[model samples]
Target: MSTPSGNGDQTRRDIQQTRAELGETVAALTAKTDVKTRARTKATTAVGGLRGRVTEAGQSAKTRATQLARTVSQKASQRVTSVRQKSQHTVGAIQGSAKASAQTAGKAESSVVTSARAMSTRIGSSVRTKPLPVLAVTGAAATLAVITYRRRRFR
Candidate 1:
């Protein structure tokens, strides 16, 4: 009876040892799996953060480009408007100068006509009263005066 009881005691001790080793292995494997899961989650979050930053940078660049283009177009339109206004003013000035020149020409023509009538009347009176030699000399002097007056008037 004493020998059988010692064998039973040894067998029970070996079974208990095996169970303890199996429990330790399972705990270790569970801890490693938990650590790996945390590392993978952290990496995924970092990638998402980088993606968000890149998207924001792209949107900001597009907004700036649109604003710059609008500003350039507005400035160009203003410059074109300014040029158009200057051209219109120049055209108006030219028209005014032409009208004034036409008026001056009409006045000069009227003066020339009056001078021609006066010269004709004086020549007729001189021809009626003068002696033949005096009339010939008067006619030659009148002809030279008329020629000089016409040259000056036209100029």
Candidate 2:
């Protein structure tokens, strides 16, 4: 029932503080000694971080693939457009060439027809001017042709 001294109260407080500090140290040591729990915790954290990284990488790759596909499509479209333009130009050139060739052929055919008609007129004039010699030569040629035709037919 006697009142405690001031020094005794201070000592008691110090002892309680020491006991609290000891308890904290013991708890820290117990946590460190528990290897299985620490390892399990570390493994869970590593797995979570790795999963996040993998997911991020996958998303990045998907984005790149989409960009690549778009690039290829655009290039293909450009190439197609270029080919179409070139083909159109080539077709136009070919048509122009064909038209020029047709015109030249028409001119040549007209010249040939004119030459044939001129030769026919000259032959007619000659026959009319020399009737007796022409008849005699014609008679000789007809006789020779008949004789040759008979020989060929018999063979």
Query: Which candidate number has the best lDDT?
Result: 2
Task: Give the clashing pairs for model 2.
Answer: none
* lDDT of candidate 2 over 1-155, digit per residue (tens): 66569878999999999999999999999999999999999999999999999999978965775565555555555655664675576556555655665577755455555555665576467558746444444544555565567569869
Backbone clash numbers for all candidates listed? 0, 0
TM-score of model number 1:
0.39
Clashes counted in candidate 2 amount to: 0
Off by over 4 Å in 1: 1-42, 98-155
Give the Cα RMSD of candidate 2: 33.3
For each candidate in the order shown, give its overall lDDT on alpha carbons.
Answer: 0.66, 0.68
Instruction: Please tell me which predicted candidate would have the highest TM-score against the true structure.
Output: 2
Q: Per-residue CA lDDT of candidate 1, range 36-143, in tens?
A: 887988999999999999999978865775565455555555655664675576556555555665577655455555554655565566546644534444554555
Q: lDDT, candidate 2, residue 34?
A: 100
TM values, all candidates: 0.39, 0.56
TM-score of 2: 0.56
Clashing pairs in 1: none
